[model samples]
Target: MKKNSINRVIGFVIVGLVLLAAVIETGRSVYTWSQQAAKQPRYTIVIDPGHGGNDPGKIGINDVPEKDVNLAISLELKEILEQNDCRVVMTRQKDEALYQAGDTNKKVADLRARCQMINDSGADAVISIHQNSFTAESSRGAQVFYRASSQEGKKLADILQTQLVSGLDPDNRRVAKANSDYFMLKNTTATMVIVECGFLSNSKEAELLTQASYQRRVAWAVALGVLQYVSGGLS
Candidate 1:
């Protein structure tokens, strides 16, 4: 062959080898991913949408109830989790309190019932969805809370806080906090995090929270956080 022809043939051989290597590497990566996916533990999570029925939790400036927002976000998160092969148990699927309609101590009874459900769920984790309200209408952003004593809860809370701020609210300054006051976090046997999605007191935030698209984003962030935790990303 002529020198130019030989050079072209050599170049083609090199390109072919490079392409073959790339294909092999891609196949190996795919195999590794499949193995990891197959070995991944199927985690069960309890999703508690706070306050229902007569208990609206917080009333937003836009006249949207916190219970509705909470439920909406929780339902979206459940769908996302289930799509990822995780089992989800919702504490309440509708706008009704866990306690009887005529119970005098309905609030307490409802909380206790939710705690019972969480404890009995045999879940890998619990995420209680809620919206915050404050005296100041300017207050905004999402916050995450976990039991102070549970390291796992703290890790999950940290992941959720990071994801929410980065994915949904870029200006969100709220960080993960430790709390012993929440019944869901304090009483649940499984590692739990309470995601205070946004402030209903803030007009801007309240409007966004009431939107289906924003609610879905919030749910997506929460679901991503849980998936990260389960995939050992925290470790």
Candidate 2:
């Protein structure tokens, strides 16, 4: 073979080898990515924003509606959870009740519909958001409640309580409580929690809860708790 021809042949072989290696590497990368995706956690969560329409829950010091606050926080949490790859299902996305307009008993219909939605979702976790009230204005801080019979519920509640206290309300001394009598807790089949984000009766908390920034912060805390629970942090 001529010298120039031999050099050209060698270059061609080298180029072909490089291309082949690139193809193999690309395949390997794609396979690894698919495996990672398969292993990634896909948790389904049900977020229930308590009260709406005519049912303005627990009017606060400045007449801040608990229903509106719940919805706002739930929406923020849903957004964060979706971004983190969690499938979030919300009970009410707007300022409307779940019950039919002409229902004979609106409150009962609303509660039943919310419960049915939560049960049907087959969710890994269910969070019912609300604001608390007390006869005394000094009541504040967040509280988490779970079904008395469900171990999963307690675990979720504990994780959430810790997150809320640590991340949002550092001064919060409240802990998770078990309740078998609550309508949603007793009726819902999945692991469920009712998070009273704050005491709306307290003027300070009512003011904070009304602010969008504070609601966003509360959502972040709830999101962290949910991630920890589903990721087996407490397991």
Candidate 3:
């Protein structure tokens, strides 16, 4: 009897998520539909899905790997961006790491490779996706970070933050933050932002992050943000 009740409650949550996710996709469509082809954004974006292979990143509710969730959302974002006629580049498309064979320090090697790819690609911008986790389980919601000194990075981060808050979680009071100590931000020359998609440490948020529909919603929110940045639409 208890199991049945739990299942029913889960079903209701899923239904509600699907509806909100649909709104996410719709917002992207409406914006693109309203733009003229001559003015459509023609830019290349490098999407880095943080962690993979040996590095599972943060373990969340149900033991879901943050690496897998990151890749899923990134792939969705790539597709959405491409559908809007933007060129997309991915650091790693499969379940693998960017480190070379027999690399002594896998983490450093992987990051270097990702940075090289972004710098060499001449991409208009770069976005590294990762799941967040905090000791405090109550800390949730997505957050954006950019290099403190880069105006371009700040612009992208703020625009993306707005999209994330308004489109996915209006309750997320977090704003775009600037950091100067991050390796990825310092190494990559292009405009870039790191998006912590949500707090995996929060049980309720972890469950939501694991859902394919919710992942797509997060991707849509990001896609809309990227499009807006590339098109010079600040709002």
- Encode model 3's per-residue lDDT on 128-163: one tens digit a residue: 999999899899999999999999999999999999
TM-scores for all predictions: 0.81, 0.83, 0.82
Expressed as tens digits, the lDDT of each residue in 141-226 for candidate 1 is 99999998999999999999999999987888999999988766777779999899999999999999999999999999999999
lDDT top scorer: 2
As for lDDT, the candidate ahead, 2 or 3, is 2
Give the Å error, residue 22, model 2: 25
Worst 10 residues of 2 by lDDT: 226-235
Alpha-carbon lDDT, every model: 0.92, 0.93, 0.93
Q: List the residue pairs that clash in candidate 2.
A: none
Better by TM-score, candidate 3 or 2: 2
Rank by lDDT, descending? Answer: 2, 3, 1
Question: Candidate 1: what lDDT?
Answer: 0.92
lDDT for each residue of candidate 2 in 1-235, tens digit (9 for 90 to 100): 9999999999999999999999999999999999999766499999999999889999999898899999999999999999887988899999988788699999989999999999999999999999999999999999999999999999999999998999887889999999989898878899999999999999999999999999999999999999999888764
How many backbone collisions does model 3 have? 0
Pairing residues by index, what is the TM-score of model 2? 0.83
**C-alpha lDDT (0 to 100) for residue 207 of candidate 1:** 93
